[model samples]
Target: MSNSRSTKLHVAIFPCFAFGHITPYLQFSNKLAKRGHRVSFLLSKGAQAKVEHLNLYPNLIHFYPLLVPSVDRLPPGAEATSDVPFPLHGHLCIAIDQTLDQVQTVLSSLKPDFIFFDFSLWMPALAHQTGSKAIYYSVITPVAQALKVPSKQKPEDMTLEDFMQLPPGYPSSSVRIKSKDFETAQLKVVANDLGTGMSIYVRITSSMIWSDAMAFRTYHEVEGPYCDYLRKHYGKPVLLTGPVLPETPATKLLDEKWTNWLCNFKQGAVVYCAFGSQNKLQKDQFQELLLGFKLCRQPFLVALSTPDGCATIEEAFPEGFEESVKGRGWVYGGWVPQTLILEHPSIGCSVTHCGYGSMLMVEELKVAVEVEREDNGWISKESLSKAIISVMGEDSEIAGLVKYNHAKLKEELTSEGMQERYLGTFIQNLQGLLD
Candidate 1:
């Protein structure tokens, strides 16, 4: 199918304040721009610098800065992952509400042909009202494998009864893990029963995102089983856009001494540890992670995100701790050379929050073995283990049921791969089934 080249196909992209959410949207717009589409990336004031750092960014890609209210109470803009204070989280919710108003107006004036939205915005209907092709770009969920036979098994299928009643090890996070769209219909019913007033905006965003025609990030070779499950059950098409990451040219800008040190390691040797943009660690949680890395005893690089006033690692962690991990690890306050670090020959594994961007990176590069946190996706642990077992250990159980099936995915990733993001498989699925 020949896609008529979009000559200045103006596209608007927006994400929440969290870096994990914001980064993927920026990467998506970048891909669109490369295909000759005019792109505008919506970002908070503080978030603009990272996107601006890209050579073709902000200048070639139009930028709309959100004048987010500087509330005194909030923590610095990071994900809700760690020990960020109550004021910080409350501020984020406030900022989100504020951005919604700003975003609505922006869409009204720019009047782009298409608008790509991340899940947190709560305003898909607003974009739709602006006469834009609202693409509900999901950073979560699995690929839909539309094969002739059922190649995957969901958690609900195997058990004696409800899988939640089973032990923690039972497999969950399937393509058929209960259709979020189908469940929302039930939620609409339950909400009506209770006579609660969750806003119409919330309802609309939920409906669009949970719809079966939404796109998935994993390539078919990587998430074949989840894709198969969805293909077998819903028959709704799914687009499979593989790993999306930004280019970091800053490493070469580093001083000679530090640059020389980075050159010494073999490719894929260092482990980069970070919770996703939303997860802020309590002081103890931060230390527990520190201890976990100390146990691993490998070369580590960590990105320690902090609130604006609470940016000090010395205050957050124990003193002289920098000396303890010196030479072995490097920790930055915010932002690191993520794609460059993962693809680095010396870098080996990563400890991450199992976020989409981070998950996509490890999956594409086969870079890390993740330390299990809350299991957000059924495929994450299975995928990470498959990617990292050679450098780490044998396949340990992820959310249970020994994904012995992951062996095939592991082999596929180690060979020729897919980095689909633009007019890739998932977008095709959306145009075919959901449009």
Candidate 2:
């Protein structure tokens, strides 16, 4: 714990099973533990093992079991949305519903000072029953909260095009979804319930309603207006808890093969590309992206997430594709240590899904120039190549902006001291209740 004088409170965190959600919650748990607070990280049987392996704050944090109920179509050990196909996400939500009884029991017994949850809409009510303060710790942006569907509009009635249209109360016209990027079929399925009883949007709306306060995984400098909008829209206190930054592990040499591979490139020369865990690109789009990287002929490292039952990387790759880009690029299947890669000297830019976790890390480092796939959704081979070249090309303006913005954001995120200060305020606010 830092020497900062204060009170310590027990904080319980219940993150969804996905790595995107789990990583931030773990970081938040570490942050609270570092402040000399006891943290109970409630995990489903599936997520517990993976999280325990991370060896984060072993002494400060305690792990508790939350059962993931058996659901049809979902594999036995699967608890996270990332563990299954994107289409199966609703099933995971249904499985999460099973945890209600277990969570209530464990939480009531532990009776922590505060309980933090992600996407668990029932948590706030559970916290209330247990005499614990509840905070909805959102990993996604405030945009979801800013846009509210009219009472008359049912999600089932809305099409992908309808969803793409800007919702009421949107602060700007700049946030509309693009045609290519919108997954109509997949989203339509997710829009309706898969035995979860409530849709994902309903879960989000209800969580905000039942919580004591809302905590966002963003800062005022970047999304102040949206945060302000959310406060008014929800009629609740919204706390912009600085981007929950992950601490670099001390022993990151888990994979020496990639470590040696990355060191060969010049400083700020390699393009690091990874679309988060849950996003799945059709085979054609994946090939186009690969061809684009090959077209640029730059040194790059791309991590591709193969679908749930895909045979191998070879199955997904174009014939002879690996041989063609052998020296210039490396395409790996499954998990990549993004933070370690970003910290590498050879890393120059990242082409990512623009997931908040990835973006916040890139912004914090201010090192890698980011090219988000979500910016224009899907693009042709030529456009994809152009985007890569725009970032990698010598004397390109985009490269310059990447360098400048990285430094500026890094300074702002650190120097502003918002994360630490906001966390202190959060503790104080909760402490006041006890007083």
Best by TM-score: 2
Q: At residue 21, what lDDT does model 2 achieve?
A: 80
**TM-score list, all predictions:** 0.64, 0.87
Off by over 4 Å in 2: 1-5, 148-164, 177-190, 251-254, 307-309, 355-378, 416-418, 433-435
Q: Candidate 1 regions off by >4 Å?
A: 1-8, 55-60, 70-91, 120-122, 143-213, 224-237, 245-258, 264-269, 276-278, 306-311, 315-334, 355-435
Each model's total of backbone clashes:
35, 1
In terms of lDDT, model 2 sits at: 0.74
By summed lDDT, the worst window of 10 consecutive residues in model 1 runs over 143-152
Q: What's model 2's lDDT at 9? A: 83
lDDT of candidate 2 over 290-344, digit per residue (tens): 8888888788899988743467766888778989988889988778877878888
Which 10-residue span in candidate 2 carries the lowest summed lDDT? 355-364
lDDT agreement with native, every candidate: 0.52, 0.74
